[model samples]
Target: MGKKTTHKFKAEVSQLLDILVHSLYTNKEIFLRELISNASDALEKARFKTQASGETDELAPEIRVTVDADAKTLTVTDTGVGMTRDELMRNIGTIAHSGTAELAKLAEQGKESLDSLIGRFGVGFYSVYMVADEVTVTTKSMDADARPIVWTSDGRTDYKLQELDEDRPHGTEITVSLKEDLASQFTNEAHLKHVVKTHSNFINFPIYVGGERVNTIQALWREPKFQIKAEQYAEFYKFLTFDSEDPFDTLHTSVDAPVQFNALMFIPRHGNDPFGLGRENRGLDLYVRRVLIEKQNKDLLPEYLGFIKGVVDTEDLPLNISRETLQDNLLMRKISSTLVKQVLDHLAKMAKDDADRYNEFWRAHGELFKAGYMDFLNKDKFAGLVRFNSSSLDDDKGLTSLADYIARAKEDQKEIYYAYGPSREALALSPHLEVFRRKHVEVLYLFEPIDEFVMDALREYEGCALVSAEHADMAKLDKFESMEKEDKPEPLSDEQKTELDKLLARMKDVLGDAVTEVKASTRLSESPVCLANPDGNVTSSMDKIMRVMSKDTSIPKKILEINPDHALIRNMLAILEKDENDPFIDQAANQLYESALLLEGYLTDPHALVGRVQDLLTKSSSWYVASGK
Candidate 1:
């Protein structure tokens, strides 16, 4: 053995290592990932060197991870370019090249603290100390005449280096003698294989653990789109999600503007947590050069887009010591914003080019994606992707985008109209749709509770306000001409108008503060009555959602709009004209109020409705028999 030399780690570097081994122990398994990643990097550099020198090496680039159970040692070996004595000292023996010194200086200046520097640099090699008490690295450089060297460290203050007499393979091998308590954890073949598969499975070169190839799955996202086949994407999707079914759609994007990243995102055919169980925590796997930094990184995409799965590999992100997560939130946001925009662009394309597929996507994901209205920064793009069943569509299964709705809408339409109910069948019977139907205007049907919140969050899109149907009383729908229906009813005469005004007054007195106002509705066409939002700020849908969230079943007061042309209202007016205080008058007014509640989906109990209908039925039957029909 040649003379050995010892080098000391700076105090701050020592503290940083302590932080890595102890403070960042949320996942102790990540130490294995870091070592594998280092070996992979070394192998990549070796490949580049051989290619750059125009020399073909006999051996293909490889990484082997092995554990010695009896020895309690874990070793990671790589066929790559190795470093010399001076190079090892510069790279491993000192903190100079590793940015530890600069980070410490920054800490001294109070720009950042020593504790905060835990994951801000790439000193991943030291992570081995988390599981190992001692580490030995043996290497022979690719240089023809270079001598082999051994670098050994206890990961305390100092490390020593010695020159070896005999030559070895021109690559590096790192062996870590596991700490007694951690030996069983890493020495177990299955656990080590799992750690490798989870983190470094996508390494360009092959990775073998315990002499069996473990990382056989390629990093499909890193490949160019032209090189990828549809079958490959499908297979990759299955491997990624463990789903037997192929993805509904795959978006392979390489974004450069705002930030640079390569993302292969899969929209599943369907989600397990369709009801949003654990939805907020779902995220994409974030990778730096195909080595996973964070699994299910929630910051990459909002919970609303949690249905989207797969990997995001970006060179733009900086990893901390453990590579457990990213260093900067702003950089993450930039990537996230770019990814979201790209996804929206793809969906818009899908909507245009592949209507059938896009419709299926809407049906499967609308409940999940509609919640994205809270991302107000991308409101316009999100609006274009939002799909809703419209009044113009024959069935609830039919959907229309806000852009499409606007395209088919009357030119004078200034607001994007929407309504909420149990189903398309229920919304079709809604009195609020009367005027929209007459004017041939489309109204979005919101079936889920979340869609109400979506409309409230996104108040407008592309210069048009998102108006809920409950607030149709406030919309400017009178300007458009009504569609020609057979035998359109005449306007009420002045005398009858005076009588109807009296009826509205009587209804207010009968219903009291239960209604904000009782007025003849210009928006109502077929249905006799419907409820409206007196406080436009809180539409009926918004209020309903709020109540449900609060677990409150109590219905609040709303505006009552009546159609004078409807037979029910006309009969009520006749009863009021003949006898102002008749007991039947109060029954008629209260019945209409409850009927409006039923139409608006706020009627929890049908007992009152049942009693009213029976009373009307009894009187109609008696009248029918007395008339000798």
Candidate 2:
């Protein structure tokens, strides 16, 4: 040492030191992360300068974390831009901000507020004091005129600054004399290596621990998309998620407007969880300038896009002084908005260019992504991306988008109709589909319970209201008649129509409050009866979900739509004509109501329906035997 002097720390810096050590930080291991980030930033600056000057700055930049257990010390050395005596005094010996009194109040307010540190200490270098009783820095500047100097501090009230005559390399070295309580955790080589891998693994420079490199994973998101190969992306994805298979689709996005961010996202072949459900709070790794700021940050993307897995690196996010939490929600929201648009744009492009691949993406992620109907700002885009099995399709394997359905829609049709059920086959059996089938209209088959919510959220798409088939207007649907003829019974005459009116009234009376109304329906062809919601404000799917959540097992009341043209209704009418108060008529009405309930999946008790079914079967068998063939 050539010369030595002592200096007192700024008033606010002393208070902030107390907060950093005792109050704010719950995880003490991150202090090493803060130190490493500062080192990385320094190295980046040196690298930029070398590029600007078109020459080597001194040495190839690298970060080395060395742990000394016996000596109770940990040292982090970085070959980057170093500081001079004056720079050290200004940066470390005193306050990094002006107005000490004002910042002192801010620091005092944060005594228990783990929120922010008003007194920032040179890009978070002060974090070292969390595990140390004293810290020593030895450095020589890249400027040849500057001499090697040393700054030692206890981080309490003051620090010691001295000049060195020995010729040290141009870089910065920080060694911490660990505090007694934190020595075992901070000075263990394995523990320090783990911390580096968790937080600073993507640092631009190489990091070595005990002669072995620790940060080997590349920050691939920052690279140009075209420059990388598919194999490289697969390797990175596997390393990120530990999944052996490659991704179904990869979205490599670099956005410059609203908020600048580079994101490389993946849609896994099977979701991150085995269930294939994507509506989760699972988030992506959030990095600021290539350094991990928050892992699995849930707010970066909406929960509907939870199936998307990858890293997001932004260069201009405002972070709290601790860098542990986001500071500005508005900036974050802007970034989120940009991410959503880019993702939707990419998906729409995928849909247009490669439909088979897009449908494969849907099979894997549609259940999760459908919940995005709540994203109204991009509802049109989301609607365009949705895929559903339809009535016109032969099986569930065949899927269609709303755009395709609309392209083939009838000229007079004004709504996009859908029917909800557990499977494609179940929806196909819905009585609401008869008219659509007759007129050759397409009806989307919605399977998941969440599909109801999606339809409700997205009330319309491209000028067409999304209407459930159960709530279809009979008067409007009757207009579009199919030209094909059926080989069925003749139309009813005036006298039979009068007889059917009495039968309808009788059936409604027997069912009591079980049905709101029992009326004739042209919407049914083969099916004898179907249930419809009378309220019109709620669809059957929505009502069923609400009833189930409330733990109400009772069957919901609904309007019964009877196909008078069907043989069952004609026979019932004839029986009513013979005897106005017949036992068979009452039994048949009750059975019809319960059967409708069963079709709607709301029937809680089926004993009565089963007994009626057996009675009718036995009577028909007796008639067949009595008739002698």
Candidate 3:
């Protein structure tokens, strides 16, 4: 051992240390990940240098981790190009090389922004302080003339460097003295192995724990698709997701166009945390040149893709001075945009190539796709990837793609129609869809509430407008029919219709603003009444979601459409002739309006509905008893 000289950290180094020790990272465990990543990077650098020099010797490229329980020390060794004495002083003693100086300047200037600093700095080295009290780095350069060097830092205010004459090999080794509280956990071989296996199993080089090789899983994202076998992919999925079941869908894509990237994404077989659980966080692991940058990085993918678990590797990322912050590099944004497009394209192709398999994926992740449609409303690329069950198709059948729906549209069809209800059966049986079904118009069945917003956002596909079947303009669809005017009978007599208008006005007064306008239904068949929204501003689905979010129970107003041909409508018209003053008749009409509102999924006062129904039932029972006796 050589004589050690103590030195104060640079002005900026002191500032960076203060920030890092205070609140730089949210999780302390991430310190291990950062150290492992640095080891991997060093190993990669050594391998590249060796390959360039065409030297093949005893120094093989690998990363080895050793835990010493008795000493309370953990060491990560890498067979890479070690630093010389001057290099050690520059790389370890000074924070300039790591870009910490730049960050300090930014902080001083009050221009601190994670977006610009992340990826440029190499602060990942300091994360060791979070768990360790002292760190020592021993390195021997590849040059035979260069002597070994040791750099030591207690992470307080100073560090030391000196020349050493130990019989060290040509590589780097980092030893950390575990903090007293964490010493026991670090001493456990099993615990250390588990952490290595969980976070660094796919590292390109082998990682050994307790003198035993631990990392056996291959980095499949780095391998060519043709070289990867199905079993290998399955195993990789199982490892990446930590799931026993196989993935429902897997997309492995590599592109160089907008940005160079490699991605291996999988849709889980089960929907464990769907519905957002609060707000969904991004689950994709981000990497730069096969080295892990962040696990479950929230910025790599959109929030709607939280269900997807995968790895994305790119070489063009701009890491901050500490390699801790991920700065907003244009390259990263380009890569992100390209990745989203590629996933959407892959889904579209899968739906076309194998409908059955794609249906399974849709069943598991369809809600996420719907969410993407709602949140990324302007992302038509993602919108085109959505699939839905259609009333036009058979039950227990495959989903309808947006492109397929467009291809099957009639030449004169001005809109792509859709209907939302609780389920496929409910939508198909809805009186709202009766007119479209009669005209042989295919209506897409939307069972989920979010689907309404999705359809609204994707208003037009292939130049055809997306029209909800319950929209008031659906009445205009009748004009598109080739039926002659003489074929269909007039709705009602002019005088009876005039009287009916007066009746609707009186009912609207009783119902207050709840009824926008009560009109004769042109869309209903078996159902006595239904509701329609003429002003497309707010759909029933939006109302439902808002009500749940606000926890408010106030009912929204809606227009009532009474089917003229239905038996209930005929009876009400007859009752108006002899019983204009009958309280039972008024109760029945009001109940019919309220029932229509309920069926349409509008907000309604349930207590008022119950009272009206009871009154009508009592009046009918009394009339029956009076006539019989």
Candidate 4:
């Protein structure tokens, strides 16, 4: 062996390589991807040269990976534009030099084209050190007379280079002697083949592992949508998801202006159970020039759209800095914002073009989609896509979007009203909806756990504020213009009104701080009583939210509104007039308050309410016995 010259790696390179081998890459297997991607770039350069010069070489563009388990060595070879000794020293010896800059220089001489080159960050070749204890490279230039050269690195501080006497093929070959711990993983033929198929399966050049072709799946997103067929999309979706069912929606998007990218995304036939898989499991695969950089990369899309599965290939993305993470860069932000807009716009289109399909999607993924409702940048857009069961809807399965609700709203209505409950039946029976029903005003039924959060974040839709049905402000809403103007109930006689006021004071005294206020309510048309948060106090939804967050559980005081015209209240007045201290009246008053609390979903101790009801039942039984019935 000739005397090899030992040269130190660049200062920036040594530090960068240390980070890559120890910190930058989440998985050491990424070394294989980086090396293979570099090999693919060399092959692409070779193809471009041949095309530009109209000269052919005997070597076809191919990447071959061979693993020797016993020797604990992995080798990757590519038949592409090889480098001369000087070129090897300059390209691989130094770090952070743009490989594309060299190609650009060659283009100036009419010898190479920079358009097809895939690598810009020169440090990708150094990732081999992440898995390997040592790496060896052998290359000969595409020029027939060029001498072959060898470069070796231990990946720490220095690399060695030497010229070879023997003639070499026109390409580059890299051999990695993996560390003792990584031998079984990197040296096994099956494991190496799997890595190749996972990372470089869609590289334009064929990749062979263990003498078997591994990159069989084409990067279909790279193909124009016009040239692709429906069957092809179905086949690709099946291949991507492994689900037999067709995708609910497919968005094949390609953009070039802000940041170039091609995305083939699929809204699954069914939403992914993110909780089951861990939220981190949901994301799109990120690729650069058809080579997988990150698998299920969450940063590509917001968590709300995590149910979406697909591949996003962007040549403009600076994924070379770290195989483990794409830095939070402007380009990535641009891509993410663009992707979110595309998804929202696609959903909007689906809603407009086909109601049933959109409704089907909403039924399957509405909870997942609710995440976007809180995104202030697109709040209005997301508001138009929010779905709910409304009073006008026939059933729970029948959903109405905010836009539709607003469209069908009364001309004078200034707010969108919603009532929250555990189920549609429960919400339908809520006393808070009585006045709305009497006036024939629609009320959206919110049942999803996240529905409250969505409404809270989206305080308004269109030009109207979102108001809860239980809100005291509902009384101020414009009354139905066509509501029959029934004669107002005769004003209670002055003495009767005084008696009623005295009765309210007695009840308030009995309840103490439990009742914020006991007053007559016109909002109630059928129900005897209902609860409302004192104006400017925390709402019921806010109370529920605080409890869910493990915050204070103290019951918020509420105003107990009684329907003065109701028969129950009239009888209570007569009982109070005869005996203001009647024990039966006290029991009835407390029970009424508990019933209101139960309806409001604030009664935490149902056993106490049950006991109260039992006492009332016993009292009734004694009265019946006393009357000899």
Across 226-269, the per-residue lDDT of candidate 3 in tens digits comes to: 99888888899998877898887788988877778789998887
Which tens-of-lDDT digit does each residue in 357-460 have in candidate 1?
99998877777787787888878788778888888888867878877888887887878989888888787787878777777778898888888878878788
Total colliding residue pairs, candidate 2: 0
Badly placed stretches (over 4 Å) of model 4 are 1-26, 68-73, 96-121, 130-134, 152-168, 177-185, 274-278, 320-322, 472-478, 481-491, 606-629
Model 2, 362-433: lDDT tens digits are: 888787788788888988898889888888788888889888888888887889999888887677677878
Worst 10 residues of 1 by lDDT: 109-118
TM-score of model 4 vs. true structure: 0.88
State every prediction's TM-score relative to the real structure.
0.89, 0.94, 0.81, 0.88
The predicted structure with the larger TM-score, 1 or 4, is 1
Candidate 2 Cα errors over 4 Å, as ranges: 51-55, 98-112, 118-123, 273-281
Instruction: Tell how far residue 532 is off in model 4, in angstroms.
Output: 1.1
- Best candidate, lDDT: 2
lDDT of residue 465 for candidate 4: 87
Regions of model 1 farther than 4 Å from truth: 13-26, 56-59, 97-118, 255-260, 272-274, 278-281, 411-415, 457-465, 473-476, 484-498, 550-553, 572-577, 604-609
- Kindly give the number of clashing pairs for every candidate: 2, 0, 16, 0
lDDT for residue 24 in candidate 2, whole number 0-100: 43
Give the per-residue Cα lDDT of candidate 3 at 248.
76
The sequence of per-residue lDDT tens digits that candidate 4 reaches over residues 382-497 is: 99998899989888789998888989998778889887888878877788787787677889988866888898899888788898887737546545742544334556678778
- lDDT score, candidate 4: 0.80
Give Cα distance to truth, residue 140, candidate 3, Å.
2.6
